[model samples]
Target chain A: MSIITENNDIEDIKIEGEYDGIIELDQWFDPKAENSVLLILNQRIKLDHSAFEALWNSYTIKICADGAANRLFDYYRDSDGKRYHPDVIAGDMDSIREDVLEYYEAIETTTVIKQNTQYSTDFTKSVNVATLLLLGIDLNAVEINEYDGIHKLYQQADKSQLKDIPLLILNGIDGRFDHTIHSMVQFYALRRQDPYFKMCFLTMSDMIILIPSSKKGYWLKLDKVKPLIGNCGLLPLAGPNIITKTKGLKWDVEDWPTSIESGNVSSSNRFVGENCLIACEESIVMSVELKWDKITQHLIDESE
Target chain B: MSIITENNDIEDIKIEGEYDGIIELDQWFDPKAENSVLLILNQRIKLDHSAFEALWNSYTIKICADGAANRLFDYYRDSDGKRYHPDVIAGDMDSIREDVLEYYEAIETTTVIKQNTQYSTDFTKSVNVATLLLLGIDLNAVEINEYDGIHKLYQQADKSQLKDIPLLILNGIDGRFDHTIHSMVQFYALRRQDPYFKMCFLTMSDMIILIPSSKKGYWLKLDKVKPLIGNCGLLPLAGPNIITKTKGLKWDVEDWPTSIESGNVSSSNRFVGENCLIACEESIVMSVELKWDKITQHLIDESE
Candidate 1:
């Protein structure tokens, strides 16, 4: 018996096998698709080299948000004695070290764009760059002197060409609580404006995906390559209480009423089956534990 | 001009002169009050020695949640050459190293309780133990052999004797995202059942507090000893959209309507004044960045 949605509409949103394309990066590589962009933020956490390399190889564009350039430089400097340059280096240029800035600027292939906008964050700037680049907007045509270059580029870009691109945001979580919350806010904001853009937040520990409540519901099929490591959670972080029904969980809920106030938020819940079906009354954040062993194995394979 | 809440009646919730007491631990010590408890969880982040020592000195009760005993033992093994034993070591015997467990057990002052309950988390078990211990319940009367010993003790404790003790939960964040969210759920659960209990989550970087909306509102005063390091944020994590009015921030909002869906959540905002006043239409999570310099200075003072 396969997992079914709350409304029993299993035929409509039944995500069978791995080809559903529901914004998950469990597979090692997507050679056919090259639209995904990996955005790196300036949080000082020991990023998994294997995970970084996997996303790097999978995605078409790699952009570093400010000081993340320094991190990338340092990461590769010690590991392989090779300078790993991002496709585009964009941010307010505050936290990026002077030497690191020079090193990246000296790289002929890297486009080091200094966006000194106080209104938006470095991560936002990187997202704007990703959108503009994905939309096939000419970098020289867009006015780069303005405070909101990305916003300007976004507004002028051909909307028809702006397809929903998967953005793998890295090092955004597990930082200071404020920054982590800010990233979450951005995640929700981007999803609300453009449902086409699939933004998946990747940390060392887990992968966070925003599961929107729709008439069709959603099916999350677990890939054999990326099995759930420890536990997963369905958090009702945003507005209103979340009434959810799930299948393929160790402790599956029929119609669990969850809210921050009611004290019934589901956390530390394990995935029991290969696939999970979620039917939510309201949009909620669902995160799956990332298996580090599989991720590191990929890294080893890449190095060999 | 001092910051005021949304309501014109500022007299009721005016937090003045750093003594308003809104569950902040900026000061090195609360010499007057010794009722607070420091609950250590098994998340393996490096605990700031100064911050840990400060909290240890401030609170009368120190309890380790399972594998946190291992952390405490490791932290003090090389330094001070003393086996700093917690008053109570509670939680399921899962992650606690065998050597570390034996070390704590050998200590005469520490009461090591093995709570092998699958229903409740280790942190929750520790909380139950804290509630029972703080209520002056006799430990001998409680059935230690049972899985739900703390829960049973909590049931039998005198209601009048129970006090709203501040619990400083350490290393709870930056681990598994599910565990972190679970800890946050517990934070709300404790607050809902008992308004008097003030649960403060402390990390290496920040202090998190939940401010509930009321006719009285809330006032959070900045302390000279505990100055804001980088930035502060007002986050609406759960329930309804938060309509907030604040002061003493770099970008003070008159009336900010923030929701997860709206994408207007305030994060990476700075504190501008000594005191900040908040009037919220709904409960919100507020966090302030901690100064590592001052914290390490406190540690230095202790060592000298």
Candidate 2:
């Protein structure tokens, strides 16, 4: 079966729904997959826990970005009065609640403390862990030091062992403006650092992921109409260049050069037709619509 | 004496407590100096006629950004059965109510019909009207058909015999993310199009305005600490390298290449000991704190 219909496999699970041009993966994916990392952050308190539990059932290794452990505990506790602990909780522990600290420590949730480091945000620290996890290093072999803040911790993550795991970031874009921009910066930074670690930012309404394309010719297929996931947009936000589009939904422009500052930018384009195909010469962040109903249903089906 | 404290061009006002650095402009300016622009869209229903009347007393003209007229009419009709009309109302008419439109037309408000335009937002149209008034152009003289779409309208605005005006934009930033982004885009575009047109965006808690700097130098004095205008952040959102230094901030940095992609943004910085000064090599967005208490006081004082 094609990956779109193969709901059993992890890749197939991310590619459910009827309409299939590009699967935004708005739904929760099985976390147990070899090429996956589950990260929870403090900002995601409103996130649906059942969806998270579904993801947790699939993803074994978890990294809580700073106060994310607090959110994880709070969300899980509110839902079922159960403590959902992460495999590793790391960041500058300033905003990390005191009760959460004690509880996580009691539950043997490995707390890697990185203090007074403003160079990177809490999300970066968790990202480093995911990167290290992708390298296949035993968690026991990584020794964190005293007086070493997040900078040093990230350094350790850099030098530590290897594997190629795909990182899925939830509740990343639906926050404050500065925070969202910071997360996007990290996304771009990760792309620069390693090509193996493919990441996707699953927003409440859309899925934003970077697809790096070379000068070589490539094509993407569209199979079915994914319900709820109605509109989609592909824009080159990183730099100043014209985007040459092959085919898309409603307003498909051929060889469109879009730079807001330098003038031409394709905003407010509609996704009407079947499968939309976007080919960019450089790496571009493509935002695809996610049908929330389809996402919830997929999660329910997976859990069942 | 700073322009903040050395006021009373119009007197009989009481200056109460010591402001820590927040510029509370309530009692300083008269109620009859400026016109009002109302914005009511989505869940944001923030406007009172008494407060608007104070602005109308000062302003020579008034314009509503699309659905703002709907809200204004609703308020007037709901309260005391009054049907106050505005000078002009312009937008895509997406969310505009039919009753509100008929009321405005009945009351003789110039209704600007703009459809199938995606370049400029409703707020931008209001700003354009403000520019027209400031430049001494008769609103009737301009050919309505000349302004095709919002994108083309802006091009026409660029060529129109216009005057430099200081525009006060209320409730621009605190909306939805896309709306806020559009506002920022408009800010940048306006700066690029005209140097004389000044804009000040009024938020609930803060007054944000872009101050374009000279390459060589520009000086700002911080004498009086305007009460509610406590903290301020200078964001270099424009895509260019900028060097900046400040004498009055708590943690000041010199020659900071502040760019969104670079991630060297200066946020949550404080105003230290008084009389602070910021010198930027390029244009920057400066956000200052606001005091609604002072605004209310000013309105009450005007009544007396």
Candidate 3:
């Protein structure tokens, strides 16, 4: 099965929609996928059990960045929740409450790793931790004191066996501006390191994914991802691009030249078809609105 | 006083910490500057009155993007509010409640503009509207049925008399991933069209500003920006760049290269000095933590 469909129309570079490279965003929750991982950042735990169950049901290796463990602690305490312990809690030990740390540490299955190095953020550290854990490394065997300790481990591992995997990040995209952009930068950076690993930064309403410049032709399966509210955008975060041809958008662009300085951007465009087609000369950031009512409709949707 | 300081060290184009080009972020609230304007987006109104008052004290023209009028309406109803009426309510007329629209329209100064055009976001339209009003054009004087209506008016006006102005945007930075990124794009776009205008996207906790590439050497007076919790970040949102040299960050990099694809980024860095010096080869986004205790300690701190 081919993963790309090439085209030459729409005043720039156009491609026909194909099912080969279908970005099935909803498939991240598959329990059978061993490559899938879940990482949480510090945003208040606001979703219902079903909201979490949808994410938790994925049954992936779970990790939290510092104080996110506190949020998880509170959510379990405040609601009639299925207490899901994270595989690892990692960060500078700044925001995580003492009581919460003790609670998660008491669990034999959960490991607490504190890296106080300020060179990278707790987020970058947590992401590094998740990537290594997914690579089948025993973090408990290593003494991780540096911010990039886990990162160094990943560098020495055999990447030859890895397949393209999904790292679903929760409550990570909508907080501080720098945190949000950094998340995107890491996506680009991580992909550069190992093309088999990609991240999906999620909030209750949307998910952010990158269509790497190396892969010019793309098909985004957003109907199941967003349903009726298919509000989407193709952000030129990596650099300027002369031809960004897209299909199935409410305001589809023919040959939009986008630059941060020139101000040619496509934000707030809605997905109008079952799938959207995108082709660009450079890497672009894509975000789509998410609807979980259907996902959790029958699967224990907790009313918050 | 020259706005740029030149330096030849740091393994890249370096700059001295000059008093010029000092971006005093605190001055947006001055009632004396006619160019300073306030714009509200569709985030829930959660700040204390002092929070709004700090922004309102800047006392520039106030306008809300579509449904933000509803949030302003609800905040007034739910809190110990002064009920500062917005001068204009503008957008696609979808999210704004009928009652809220009528409420603001009843006031003599407030105008309700319905521009259902999808080419631009309501934030973009509201910004266009703000820029026009700042340029001394009465919005009420024009028939604006299209998204770029206000933009057209500005293109026809005299630009020689205007000075570089500040547009303080509230509840905009942290939203949908695209919304957050789009706000930054407009800043770059607006600056491209008129070098005399700039925007500051403010949250209760932080503010985002662009250090334009055109000006290579710049000094950011961030002592007042972030007091004790000096959490800050310089994002490479516009494109790839080399040598984003800085002097005031806790882990300042020397001649660092930043790109979305390269994963080389500066996030979760903090200020350790009174002022931060920056010299970038291309446009980079900067965000800093905000401390309002000093601004609101005595100025009516309405706790939410």
Ranking by DockQ: 1, 3, 2
Estimated TM-score for each candidate: 0.88, 0.71, 0.85
Q: Write the per-residue lDDT of candidate 3 for residues B119-198, one digit (tens) a residue.
A: 66787678777767777777778686465566567567777777767777888766676777778877777776667766
| lDDT, candidate 1, B29-98, per-residue tens | 3423447678888866476666566657767888998899988887765455786678898888888999
Q: In terms of TM-score, which candidate is stronger, 1 or 3?
A: 1
Provide the lowest-lDDT 10-residue window in model 3 chain A. A1-10
Worst 10 residues of 3 chain B by lDDT: B1-10
Distance from true location, Cα of A285 in model 1, Å = 1.1
**Which candidate's TM-score is highest?**
1
* Candidates 2 and 3 compared by TM-score, better number: 3
Q: 2 or 3, which is superior by lDDT?
A: 3
Report the TM-score of candidate 1, chain B only.
0.84
- Candidate 1 residue-wise lDDT, A31-140, digit = tens: 22558788888875466666566557767888999999988877755445667778899988888999998887888778888877787778878887887778776675
Error of 3 at B161 (Å): 1.5
Clashing pairs in 3: B29-B58, B164-B196
